[model samples]
Target: MTAGPAEALHSWMPHSPCGAWCLPTGDALPKVSPARRALRLATLVAVVLTGPLCALTLSVLGPRGRAAVIRGWFRMVLGALGVRLRVYRPGALSLAPEERERPRDRGVLVVGNHSSWLDIVALNALQPVRMLAKAQVRHWPLIGALAARAGTFFVDRPRLSTLPATVAEVAGALRGGAAVGVFPEGTTWCGQATGRWKRAAFQAAIDAGVPARPVALRFVVDEQCTTAAGFLGEETLLTALLRTAALRGLVIEASVLPLVSPEGHDRRSMAAAAEAAVTEALGQPEAEHAVPEVAAAA
Candidate 1:
């Protein structure tokens, strides 16, 4: 019997070459005490419980008011997780303050590297853009509820045939002057390595005639880069959350690079350009950036 698109998609799911080997284990990583971890977890739950109230409050606010509330909520989420966030605009550093703030109002396609669930929190904290999330994320506990309320675009990976429609939906949102976030790698990896970019999401930018903005995300602990926060391999989400909560002095650096125009570029070239921009911002040598051949096949 021939396999259906759903079955084929299950088999075609992207996988990273990064695993336990890419992460720091045992004494090599700095950790907070069990008591501290418990405190962080409790605080996180408290903050999440306020999501419904926040959503209700947001419905009555104007655009500026809504953005303010969303930013505060996401910042509180990062604080609850005991993670520090630092946002940098490498491309706009030389520009005047007013010039640097201009892009915030534009509808651009935001693309970036994915390493942990924190990536979502950190990016949304920077600005309340609609993110492209896997369909399963829409069913997660409190997190899923918050994502749905925040206008996240959920992609059904199993329904591979629906991709064009998904892209069209995203394009329509972009055309309406909303920034859409996507991780074209389509899978999470340890911060030490990354996967190849998939071109499907980039098509939305081309279709909407919007620029693609590449952002680089890095997780640092105790002044050194670490993959302790990564949700990789067979690790459960609970395990990853606990691990992140226990880490001391963890900082997530998000660098916003210059935008890549979709004009005169096809989806493949546009995706490659965005990937190259992110890779450069990450400061990794070309050889150090890992692209699993298996992921490309997927």
Candidate 2:
């Protein structure tokens, strides 16, 4: 059998450690003026210093209190960076009719397209969420400390032995009515295309018997995709941050799609449905799963 579209298209490129989406046209760095860069740097320093302190304060607070504090910080950060956000709730986009009608008692597993680190800030601006991040993030200086305080689940992907335990921890959080965020694609690609989403996070939703909500994230500036915001390739976190902060009139559009039920559902099928929703929302061609090279070669 021939490789599927996703496979045929994506097989050539290697996965990136930092989240990045690849575009067909290629990557072009965004230009930031000296004055704007200086201003943005100052603003970032203030936000970075304040984020951890707020995390410490919210640690002892109730869920409502913590969420309020987080949202306030997100707004401040976005304002300073000149990044506006447009959130489309159910029905406004291609979401299913029943999306808004679903029972939200149980915490939801939110999966999305990961293109830039800014995606995290944008989503948190929507609400406080516990993120499932890679283990490398756990070592990122002040950001790591703040992320830990915010209750991020860090997984060491290379150590497959720990996956079951990590899944259990994520499932426990979901069962407790805490919304969990994950980039199931494991690696970031340019937003122009998406990769195969891993099924582990979906399994956590299944274990908790909660629904998975697929959110589509896109960064736009001057009515075009802001690929410079992505963290892929050789770009460091600091570089991505600087580029994002220097952006003018940057708008983050987060379109929340329908929630897929985990009850009596298989992880693979659930992931596929979520992927399709996100692909359509982002205006990208849906990729068919590719056959493994070893299998295809046979």
Candidate 3:
């Protein structure tokens, strides 16, 4: 028998094992004035570069080669957009005897809190980390085009059953020495704060026997948005770039916290430890009473 409308809708949106919590409503993000103007010039330049970058990649090597080229280009794009990334040095590379002896061939899982669409750009700019993205990204026309070339793994977002496979694929990529960045929040948040994290990702690291690199991204303002009260989502890429450019200074601080590995612990403790480390790094409260209780269920 055909399912009811509610069932159909329920099946369409993948409900997190961790029940949802209230989202702190935010004022629309502001796009500073001067930054808006610079955005036009910046967008034009970036668009111009994309075509040639893609062409050169295809001509020089094969499919994955094209992705590597996009990876490098992404850093340039961030600079062009005035998003400055200051990375905390890669927190200690594994040096213990067991870890040191293993050929440094496996990848690390970069678990981070999601803030804006810019978070992906920021992370991509820092290094050539591959993202296991939602399938919607693949359908976003220009974004999808670039993302595919960047070697992102596109998973069907509404299909929860696929999580197992997606995690497996990610683990395989790790085995091949490609780092994977996953936003445990599974959604974006206002630049002011991070969303509750999903702990299931700890299992990915557990299965792969890889270390989890927890990181946090924070955005600070420079100029004022057109309307002090509302955000500027309508601005084009160029516009946003110009707005940021106009800033006296636009700084994005990405602090990579301690890495958690599979040694001497269960998923629950590991997840909590990872959560505490990230919260402390972000300078946010890590109170058990505040974060979604469901997040710690794992």
lDDT of all the models against the reference? 0.79, 0.73, 0.56
Q: What would you estimate as the lDDT of candidate 3?
A: 0.56
Which digits, one per residue and each the tens of the lDDT, describe model 1 over residues 32-53? Answer: 8989889889998888898899
| Cα distance off (Å), candidate 3, residue 185 | 0.5
> How do these models rank on lDDT, best leading?
1, 2, 3
lDDT of 3 by residue, 1-298 (tens): 0112233344344222211122112334433466454664567477545755564566678646755665556666555654555555333353354532223466787777664556676676655577877776787757677667656887765567887887778777877777788877665444344556665667777777888777776654443211111112232334334434554334555666556777876667777777777777666422222221110000
How many collisions per candidate?
A: 0, 7, 9
Error of 2 at 64 (Å): 1.5
Cα deviation at 3, candidate 1, in Å, is: 19
In model 3, the worst 10-residue window by lDDT is 289-298
Candidate 2 residue pairs that clash: 6-288, 20-188, 20-189, 21-189, 21-190, 22-189, 22-190
lDDT of 3 at 10: 43
What lDDT is obtained when candidate 2 is compared to the true structure? 0.73
